[model samples]
Target: GAGVSQSPSNKVTEKGKDVELRCDPISGHTALYWYRQSLGQGLEFLIYFQGNSAPDKSGLPSDRFSAERTGGSVSTLTIQRTQQEDSAVYLCASSFEGLNYEQYFGPGTRLTVT
Candidate 1:
Protein backbone atom coordinates (compact mmCIF):
# COMPACT_ATOMS: atom_id res chain seq x y z
CA GLY A 1 0.00 0.00 0.00
CA ALA A 2 1.06 3.57 -0.50
CA GLY A 3 2.23 5.84 2.31
CA VAL A 4 0.23 8.73 3.68
CA SER A 5 -0.36 11.60 1.25
CA GLN A 6 -1.51 15.22 1.80
CA SER A 7 -2.98 17.65 -0.70
CA PRO A 8 -2.31 21.34 -1.24
CA SER A 9 1.33 20.97 -0.22
CA ASN A 10 1.50 24.69 0.43
CA LYS A 11 -1.04 27.34 1.31
CA VAL A 12 -0.86 31.09 1.90
CA THR A 13 -3.82 32.84 3.45
CA GLU A 14 -4.70 36.07 5.17
CA LYS A 15 -5.45 36.19 8.85
CA GLY A 16 -8.98 35.23 9.88
CA LYS A 17 -9.43 33.07 6.76
CA ASP A 18 -10.11 29.36 6.85
CA VAL A 19 -8.16 26.44 5.40
CA GLU A 20 -8.80 22.76 4.92
CA LEU A 21 -5.99 20.24 4.66
CA ARG A 22 -6.59 16.70 3.47
CA CYS A 23 -4.81 13.45 4.13
CA ASP A 24 -5.09 9.97 2.64
CA PRO A 25 -3.60 7.32 4.83
CA ILE A 26 -2.20 4.04 3.64
CA SER A 27 -4.88 1.54 2.79
CA GLY A 28 -5.88 -0.67 5.74
CA HIS A 29 -4.23 1.51 8.32
CA THR A 30 -6.53 2.00 11.29
CA ALA A 31 -4.79 4.89 12.94
CA LEU A 32 -4.39 8.41 11.61
CA TYR A 33 -2.86 11.49 13.21
CA TRP A 34 -2.43 15.22 12.58
CA TYR A 35 0.41 17.38 13.82
CA ARG A 36 1.66 20.94 13.48
CA GLN A 37 5.24 22.16 13.39
CA SER A 38 6.12 25.82 13.72
CA LEU A 39 9.46 27.20 12.59
CA GLY A 40 12.29 25.87 14.79
CA GLN A 41 9.80 24.01 16.96
CA GLY A 42 9.04 20.35 17.60
CA LEU A 43 6.02 18.60 16.17
CA GLU A 44 2.79 19.29 18.08
CA PHE A 45 0.20 16.56 18.08
CA LEU A 46 -3.17 17.88 16.96
CA ILE A 47 -5.54 14.98 16.76
CA TYR A 48 -5.75 11.25 16.21
CA PHE A 49 -8.24 8.65 15.07
CA GLN A 50 -8.03 4.94 15.71
CA GLY A 51 -10.40 2.37 14.29
CA ASN A 52 -14.09 3.09 14.99
CA SER A 53 -13.33 4.69 18.33
CA ALA A 54 -13.82 8.36 19.09
CA PRO A 55 -11.03 10.65 17.94
CA ASP A 56 -8.58 12.06 20.47
CA LYS A 57 -8.63 15.81 19.93
CA SER A 58 -7.23 17.09 23.21
CA GLY A 59 -4.05 18.14 21.47
CA LEU A 60 -5.75 20.69 19.27
CA PRO A 61 -4.30 24.11 20.07
CA SER A 62 -7.62 25.88 20.13
CA ASP A 63 -11.32 25.48 19.53
CA ARG A 64 -10.86 26.62 15.93
CA PHE A 65 -8.92 23.51 14.99
CA SER A 66 -10.83 20.38 14.06
CA ALA A 67 -10.41 17.12 12.17
CA GLU A 68 -12.34 14.12 10.98
CA ARG A 69 -11.64 10.73 9.43
CA THR A 70 -14.08 9.36 6.94
CA GLY A 71 -14.58 5.58 6.54
CA GLY A 72 -11.52 5.19 8.74
CA SER A 73 -9.20 6.12 5.87
CA VAL A 74 -9.02 9.65 4.56
CA SER A 75 -8.82 12.54 7.01
CA THR A 76 -9.14 16.30 6.91
CA LEU A 77 -7.90 19.05 9.24
CA THR A 78 -9.66 22.36 9.26
CA ILE A 79 -8.40 25.58 10.77
CA GLN A 80 -11.01 28.25 11.20
CA ARG A 81 -10.23 31.95 11.45
CA THR A 82 -6.59 31.37 10.85
CA GLN A 83 -4.09 33.52 12.75
CA GLN A 84 -0.58 34.58 11.85
CA GLU A 85 0.80 32.49 14.69
CA ASP A 86 -0.79 29.50 12.99
CA SER A 87 1.83 29.59 10.26
CA ALA A 88 3.50 26.20 10.24
CA VAL A 89 3.74 22.87 8.49
CA TYR A 90 0.74 20.62 9.04
CA LEU A 91 1.77 16.98 9.00
CA CYS A 92 -0.28 13.78 8.70
CA ALA A 93 0.77 10.35 9.80
CA SER A 94 -0.66 6.86 10.14
CA SER A 95 0.12 3.39 11.43
CA PHE A 96 -1.43 -0.04 11.71
CA GLU A 97 -2.35 0.82 15.26
CA GLY A 98 -2.11 3.85 17.53
CA LEU A 99 0.96 5.71 18.76
CA ASN A 100 2.40 2.49 20.12
CA TYR A 101 3.17 1.34 16.60
CA GLU A 102 5.62 2.69 14.10
CA GLN A 103 4.13 5.69 12.37
CA TYR A 104 4.70 6.93 8.82
CA PHE A 105 4.43 10.64 7.97
CA GLY A 106 3.40 12.43 4.82
CA PRO A 107 5.07 15.40 3.16
CA GLY A 108 3.58 18.11 5.38
CA THR A 109 1.41 20.93 4.06
CA ARG A 110 3.15 24.22 4.68
CA LEU A 111 0.73 26.97 5.67
CA THR A 112 1.45 30.65 5.95
CA VAL A 113 -1.06 32.99 7.53
CA THR A 114 -0.26 36.66 7.17
Candidate 2:
Protein backbone atom coordinates (compact mmCIF):
# COMPACT_ATOMS: atom_id res chain seq x y z
CA GLY A 1 0.00 0.00 0.00
CA ALA A 2 1.05 3.58 -0.53
CA GLY A 3 2.46 5.00 2.68
CA VAL A 4 2.19 8.70 2.00
CA SER A 5 3.59 11.09 -0.56
CA GLN A 6 4.16 14.78 -1.11
CA SER A 7 5.27 16.57 -4.24
CA PRO A 8 8.01 19.10 -5.06
CA SER A 9 10.03 18.02 -2.03
CA ASN A 10 11.13 21.64 -2.15
CA LYS A 11 9.61 24.89 -3.33
CA VAL A 12 11.04 28.39 -3.66
CA THR A 13 8.93 31.45 -4.28
CA GLU A 14 8.93 35.19 -3.95
CA LYS A 15 6.70 37.10 -1.63
CA GLY A 16 3.04 37.56 -2.62
CA LYS A 17 2.85 34.46 -4.75
CA ASP A 18 0.66 31.42 -4.28
CA VAL A 19 1.73 27.79 -3.97
CA GLU A 20 -0.08 24.54 -3.55
CA LEU A 21 1.38 21.44 -1.91
CA ARG A 22 -0.06 18.00 -2.34
CA CYS A 23 -0.35 14.98 -0.08
CA ASP A 24 -1.42 11.41 -0.81
CA PRO A 25 -2.17 9.20 2.13
CA ILE A 26 -2.44 5.46 2.40
CA SER A 27 -5.57 3.63 1.38
CA GLY A 28 -8.16 2.60 3.98
CA HIS A 29 -7.06 5.30 6.37
CA THR A 30 -9.96 7.45 7.53
CA ALA A 31 -7.98 9.98 9.59
CA LEU A 32 -5.73 12.59 8.03
CA TYR A 33 -3.92 15.64 9.31
CA TRP A 34 -1.80 18.57 8.10
CA TYR A 35 1.01 20.15 10.05
CA ARG A 36 3.85 22.60 9.63
CA GLN A 37 7.31 22.52 11.20
CA SER A 38 9.40 25.63 11.16
CA LEU A 39 13.14 25.48 11.71
CA GLY A 40 13.80 24.15 15.17
CA GLN A 41 10.10 24.22 15.94
CA GLY A 42 7.80 21.38 16.93
CA LEU A 43 5.12 20.13 14.64
CA GLU A 44 2.24 22.56 14.49
CA PHE A 45 -1.12 21.19 13.61
CA LEU A 46 -2.80 22.99 10.76
CA ILE A 47 -6.02 21.16 10.16
CA TYR A 48 -7.55 17.78 10.76
CA PHE A 49 -10.29 15.97 8.87
CA GLN A 50 -11.83 12.80 10.16
CA GLY A 51 -13.63 11.39 7.18
CA ASN A 52 -14.93 14.65 5.57
CA SER A 53 -15.50 17.00 8.45
CA ALA A 54 -12.87 19.43 9.69
CA PRO A 55 -12.91 19.39 13.44
CA ASP A 56 -9.80 21.46 13.96
CA LYS A 57 -8.17 24.48 12.37
CA SER A 58 -6.65 26.17 15.37
CA GLY A 59 -3.06 25.79 14.22
CA LEU A 60 -3.20 27.39 10.81
CA PRO A 61 -0.76 30.28 10.95
CA SER A 62 -2.85 32.74 8.99
CA ASP A 63 -5.45 33.18 6.31
CA ARG A 64 -2.86 32.25 3.72
CA PHE A 65 -2.74 28.63 4.83
CA SER A 66 -5.60 26.38 3.90
CA ALA A 67 -6.12 22.71 3.09
CA GLU A 68 -8.75 20.35 1.76
CA ARG A 69 -9.11 16.59 1.54
CA THR A 70 -10.84 14.69 -1.23
CA GLY A 71 -12.35 11.20 -1.09
CA GLY A 72 -10.90 11.01 2.38
CA SER A 73 -7.53 10.16 0.93
CA VAL A 74 -5.68 12.90 -0.93
CA SER A 75 -5.23 16.38 0.45
CA THR A 76 -3.78 19.69 -0.69
CA LEU A 77 -2.48 22.60 1.28
CA THR A 78 -2.48 25.96 -0.40
CA ILE A 79 -0.59 29.00 0.72
CA GLN A 80 -1.73 32.26 -0.77
CA ARG A 81 0.19 35.55 -0.84
CA THR A 82 3.28 33.82 0.40
CA GLN A 83 5.63 35.60 2.74
CA GLN A 84 9.08 34.76 4.03
CA GLU A 85 7.48 34.13 7.34
CA ASP A 86 5.48 31.34 5.76
CA SER A 87 8.57 29.34 4.93
CA ALA A 88 8.49 25.95 6.62
CA VAL A 89 8.40 22.23 6.05
CA TYR A 90 4.82 21.15 5.63
CA LEU A 91 4.18 17.60 6.80
CA CYS A 92 1.13 15.43 6.26
CA ALA A 93 0.21 12.36 8.22
CA SER A 94 -2.48 9.72 8.38
CA SER A 95 -3.56 7.26 11.01
CA PHE A 96 -6.05 4.56 11.79
CA GLU A 97 -9.12 5.16 13.86
CA GLY A 98 -8.99 4.71 17.61
CA LEU A 99 -6.51 5.48 20.37
CA ASN A 100 -2.77 4.77 20.23
CA TYR A 101 -2.76 4.86 16.47
CA GLU A 102 0.53 6.07 15.00
CA GLN A 103 0.62 8.65 12.28
CA TYR A 104 2.71 8.01 9.20
CA PHE A 105 4.35 11.10 7.72
CA GLY A 106 5.38 11.93 4.21
CA PRO A 107 8.75 13.30 3.17
CA GLY A 108 7.25 16.75 3.41
CA THR A 109 7.24 19.77 1.11
CA ARG A 110 9.77 22.37 2.03
CA LEU A 111 8.55 25.84 1.04
CA THR A 112 10.99 28.68 0.99
CA VAL A 113 9.86 32.25 0.51
CA THR A 114 12.12 35.06 -0.55
Candidate 3:
Protein backbone atom coordinates (compact mmCIF):
# COMPACT_ATOMS: atom_id res chain seq x y z
CA GLY A 1 0.00 0.00 0.00
CA ALA A 2 1.05 3.59 -0.57
CA GLY A 3 0.33 4.48 2.99
CA VAL A 4 -0.57 2.94 6.31
CA SER A 5 -3.97 1.29 6.59
CA GLN A 6 -6.06 0.15 9.53
CA SER A 7 -9.09 -2.09 9.81
CA PRO A 8 -12.63 -1.46 11.06
CA SER A 9 -12.45 2.30 10.98
CA ASN A 10 -14.87 2.25 13.90
CA LYS A 11 -15.58 -0.22 16.66
CA VAL A 12 -18.13 -0.26 19.44
CA THR A 13 -17.88 -2.76 22.23
CA GLU A 14 -19.33 -3.27 25.65
CA LYS A 15 -17.31 -2.80 28.76
CA GLY A 16 -15.21 -5.87 29.63
CA LYS A 17 -15.14 -6.99 26.04
CA ASP A 18 -11.89 -7.53 24.22
CA VAL A 19 -11.05 -5.77 20.98
CA GLU A 20 -8.34 -6.20 18.42
CA LEU A 21 -7.24 -3.49 16.02
CA ARG A 22 -5.11 -4.12 12.99
CA CYS A 23 -2.64 -2.02 11.02
CA ASP A 24 -0.70 -2.50 7.84
CA PRO A 25 2.18 -0.13 7.34
CA ILE A 26 3.55 1.14 4.07
CA SER A 27 5.81 -1.30 2.35
CA GLY A 28 9.42 -1.22 3.63
CA HIS A 29 8.65 0.96 6.62
CA THR A 30 10.86 -0.29 9.44
CA ALA A 31 9.02 1.21 12.37
CA LEU A 32 5.41 0.86 13.54
CA TYR A 33 3.69 2.62 16.41
CA TRP A 34 0.38 2.39 18.23
CA TYR A 35 -1.24 5.25 20.08
CA ARG A 36 -4.54 6.26 21.60
CA GLN A 37 -6.26 9.62 21.83
CA SER A 38 -9.10 10.45 24.13
CA LEU A 39 -11.36 13.44 23.82
CA GLY A 40 -9.47 16.66 24.56
CA GLN A 41 -6.28 14.79 25.35
CA GLY A 42 -2.96 14.23 23.64
CA LEU A 43 -2.04 11.05 21.86
CA GLU A 44 -0.94 8.36 24.29
CA PHE A 45 1.85 6.21 22.95
CA LEU A 46 0.95 2.54 23.32
CA ILE A 47 3.60 0.41 21.66
CA TYR A 48 6.41 0.55 19.13
CA PHE A 49 8.13 -2.00 16.95
CA GLN A 50 11.25 -1.30 14.92
CA GLY A 51 13.10 -3.78 12.78
CA ASN A 52 14.10 -6.90 14.77
CA SER A 53 14.60 -5.05 18.01
CA ALA A 54 12.45 -5.76 21.03
CA PRO A 55 9.20 -3.82 20.88
CA ASP A 56 9.10 -0.81 23.16
CA LYS A 57 5.97 -1.41 25.21
CA SER A 58 6.76 1.19 27.81
CA GLY A 59 3.81 3.28 26.70
CA LEU A 60 1.10 0.75 27.33
CA PRO A 61 -1.32 2.18 29.85
CA SER A 62 -1.96 -1.13 31.56
CA ASP A 63 -1.46 -4.85 31.40
CA ARG A 64 -4.75 -5.14 29.53
CA PHE A 65 -3.18 -3.54 26.49
CA SER A 66 -0.81 -5.37 24.18
CA ALA A 67 0.46 -5.24 20.60
CA GLU A 68 2.73 -7.03 18.17
CA ARG A 69 4.22 -6.63 14.73
CA THR A 70 4.77 -9.53 12.38
CA GLY A 71 7.27 -9.52 9.52
CA GLY A 72 7.96 -5.92 10.56
CA SER A 73 5.01 -4.80 8.50
CA VAL A 74 1.63 -5.65 9.93
CA SER A 75 0.67 -4.85 13.49
CA THR A 76 -2.19 -5.52 15.86
CA LEU A 77 -3.27 -4.01 19.17
CA THR A 78 -5.38 -5.98 21.59
CA ILE A 79 -7.23 -4.51 24.50
CA GLN A 80 -8.64 -6.95 27.01
CA ARG A 81 -11.37 -6.32 29.56
CA THR A 82 -12.09 -2.97 28.04
CA GLN A 83 -13.30 -0.26 30.32
CA GLN A 84 -15.28 2.89 29.60
CA GLU A 85 -12.05 4.82 29.82
CA ASP A 86 -10.75 2.82 26.92
CA SER A 87 -13.01 4.59 24.50
CA ALA A 88 -10.69 6.47 22.19
CA VAL A 89 -9.22 6.64 18.75
CA TYR A 90 -6.50 4.08 18.25
CA LEU A 91 -3.85 5.25 15.79
CA CYS A 92 -1.07 3.54 13.91
CA ALA A 93 1.90 5.12 12.18
CA SER A 94 4.98 4.00 10.32
CA SER A 95 8.38 5.33 9.35
CA PHE A 96 11.47 4.08 7.64
CA GLU A 97 14.55 3.59 9.85
CA GLY A 98 13.48 6.40 12.20
CA LEU A 99 15.12 9.15 10.11
CA ASN A 100 13.79 12.11 12.04
CA TYR A 101 10.83 9.69 12.30
CA GLU A 102 8.45 11.53 10.02
CA GLN A 103 5.73 8.93 10.37
CA TYR A 104 2.88 8.17 8.01
CA PHE A 105 -0.35 7.53 9.91
CA GLY A 106 -3.40 5.52 9.15
CA PRO A 107 -7.02 6.56 9.59
CA GLY A 108 -7.44 5.54 13.20
CA THR A 109 -10.05 3.15 14.49
CA ARG A 110 -12.42 4.91 16.83
CA LEU A 111 -13.32 2.62 19.72
CA THR A 112 -16.41 3.21 21.79
CA VAL A 113 -16.65 1.25 25.00
CA THR A 114 -20.02 1.40 26.57
Candidate 4:
Protein backbone atom coordinates (compact mmCIF):
# COMPACT_ATOMS: atom_id res chain seq x y z
CA GLY A 1 0.00 0.00 0.00
CA ALA A 2 1.03 3.59 -0.42
CA GLY A 3 2.39 5.72 2.40
CA VAL A 4 0.46 8.54 3.96
CA SER A 5 -0.41 11.46 1.74
CA GLN A 6 -1.37 15.06 2.51
CA SER A 7 -2.83 17.68 0.21
CA PRO A 8 -1.99 21.29 -0.49
CA SER A 9 1.66 21.02 0.55
CA ASN A 10 1.56 24.71 1.48
CA LYS A 11 -1.00 27.22 2.58
CA VAL A 12 -0.98 30.94 3.37
CA THR A 13 -3.88 32.56 5.16
CA GLU A 14 -4.76 35.71 7.03
CA LYS A 15 -5.58 35.83 10.71
CA GLY A 16 -9.13 34.83 11.65
CA LYS A 17 -9.49 32.66 8.55
CA ASP A 18 -10.14 28.95 8.62
CA VAL A 19 -8.18 26.19 6.97
CA GLU A 20 -8.43 22.46 6.47
CA LEU A 21 -5.60 19.97 6.12
CA ARG A 22 -6.09 16.47 4.77
CA CYS A 23 -4.32 13.17 5.34
CA ASP A 24 -4.72 9.79 3.68
CA PRO A 25 -3.19 6.94 5.60
CA ILE A 26 -1.86 3.75 4.15
CA SER A 27 -4.52 1.19 3.55
CA GLY A 28 -5.11 -1.17 6.52
CA HIS A 29 -3.18 1.05 8.93
CA THR A 30 -5.53 1.55 11.83
CA ALA A 31 -3.78 4.31 13.70
CA LEU A 32 -3.45 7.88 12.54
CA TYR A 33 -1.89 10.92 14.17
CA TRP A 34 -1.61 14.63 13.56
CA TYR A 35 1.27 16.79 14.67
CA ARG A 36 2.41 20.38 14.39
CA GLN A 37 5.94 21.70 14.14
CA SER A 38 6.80 25.32 14.59
CA LEU A 39 10.06 26.82 13.44
CA GLY A 40 12.96 25.46 15.46
CA GLN A 41 10.60 23.41 17.61
CA GLY A 42 10.00 19.72 18.05
CA LEU A 43 6.95 17.94 16.68
CA GLU A 44 3.91 18.52 18.85
CA PHE A 45 1.22 15.85 18.86
CA LEU A 46 -2.14 17.29 18.00
CA ILE A 47 -4.53 14.34 17.81
CA TYR A 48 -4.67 10.59 17.30
CA PHE A 49 -7.16 8.02 16.16
CA GLN A 50 -7.02 4.30 16.58
CA GLY A 51 -9.45 1.76 15.15
CA ASN A 52 -13.06 2.47 16.04
CA SER A 53 -12.19 3.81 19.46
CA ALA A 54 -12.58 7.35 20.62
CA PRO A 55 -10.00 9.71 19.22
CA ASP A 56 -7.41 11.05 21.63
CA LYS A 57 -7.64 14.78 21.23
CA SER A 58 -5.95 15.93 24.40
CA GLY A 59 -3.07 17.36 22.41
CA LEU A 60 -5.18 19.87 20.54
CA PRO A 61 -4.05 23.34 21.57
CA SER A 62 -7.53 24.84 21.65
CA ASP A 63 -11.15 24.26 20.81
CA ARG A 64 -10.58 25.85 17.44
CA PHE A 65 -8.48 22.88 16.39
CA SER A 66 -10.28 19.70 15.47
CA ALA A 67 -9.82 16.56 13.38
CA GLU A 68 -11.72 13.56 12.15
CA ARG A 69 -10.83 10.29 10.47
CA THR A 70 -13.48 9.00 8.14
CA GLY A 71 -13.92 5.26 7.52
CA GLY A 72 -10.77 4.79 9.57
CA SER A 73 -8.53 5.83 6.69
CA VAL A 74 -8.58 9.49 5.70
CA SER A 75 -8.27 12.35 8.15
CA THR A 76 -8.86 16.04 8.08
CA LEU A 77 -7.51 18.63 10.53
CA THR A 78 -9.27 21.91 10.74
CA ILE A 79 -7.98 25.09 12.28
CA GLN A 80 -10.40 27.93 12.77
CA ARG A 81 -9.66 31.60 13.25
CA THR A 82 -6.05 31.10 12.35
CA GLN A 83 -3.43 33.31 13.97
CA GLN A 84 0.13 34.27 13.19
CA GLU A 85 1.35 32.03 15.96
CA ASP A 86 -0.22 29.12 14.11
CA SER A 87 2.30 29.38 11.34
CA ALA A 88 4.05 26.03 11.10
CA VAL A 89 4.09 22.67 9.36
CA TYR A 90 1.29 20.21 9.99
CA LEU A 91 2.33 16.59 9.76
CA CYS A 92 0.33 13.39 9.51
CA ALA A 93 1.45 9.89 10.39
CA SER A 94 0.04 6.40 10.61
CA SER A 95 0.93 2.95 11.86
CA PHE A 96 -0.47 -0.54 11.78
CA GLU A 97 -1.31 -0.50 15.44
CA GLY A 98 -0.41 2.05 18.10
CA LEU A 99 2.45 4.30 19.04
CA ASN A 100 4.59 1.26 19.71
CA TYR A 101 4.69 0.59 16.00
CA GLU A 102 6.80 2.45 13.48
CA GLN A 103 4.91 5.42 12.04
CA TYR A 104 5.01 6.42 8.38
CA PHE A 105 4.77 10.18 8.00
CA GLY A 106 3.55 12.23 5.08
CA PRO A 107 5.17 15.30 3.62
CA GLY A 108 3.92 18.04 5.89
CA THR A 109 1.74 20.95 4.89
CA ARG A 110 3.48 24.23 5.59
CA LEU A 111 1.01 26.83 6.79
CA THR A 112 1.65 30.52 7.15
CA VAL A 113 -0.86 32.64 9.04
CA THR A 114 -0.28 36.35 8.87
Error of 4 at 11 (Å): 0.4
Which residue ranges in model 3 land beyond 4 Å of their true spot?
none
- Candidate 1 residue 103 C-alpha distance from true site, Å: 0.3
Residues 1-114, model 3: lDDT tens digits: 488999989999999999999999999889888889999999988878886454467889999998877777788899999999999999999898865979999999999999
lDDT score of model 2?
0.89
Q: C-alpha displacement of 10 in model 4, angstroms?
A: 0.2
TM-score for each of the candidates:
0.94, 0.94, 0.94, 0.94
Flag the better candidate by lDDT, 1 or 4: 4
Return the lDDT, model 2, position 109: 96
Compared with the true structure, what per-residue lDDT tens digits does model 4 show for residues 49-84?
886454567899999998987898889999999989
Model 3 lDDT, full chain set = 0.89
Residue 101 in candidate 1, Cα distance off native in Å: 1.4
Candidate 3 residue pairs in backbone clash: none
Off by over 4 Å in 1: none
Query: What is the lDDT for 113 in model 4?
Result: 94
Model 1 lDDT tens row, 1-114: 688999899999999999999999988889888899999999998888886454566899999998887888888899999999999999998889855688899999999999
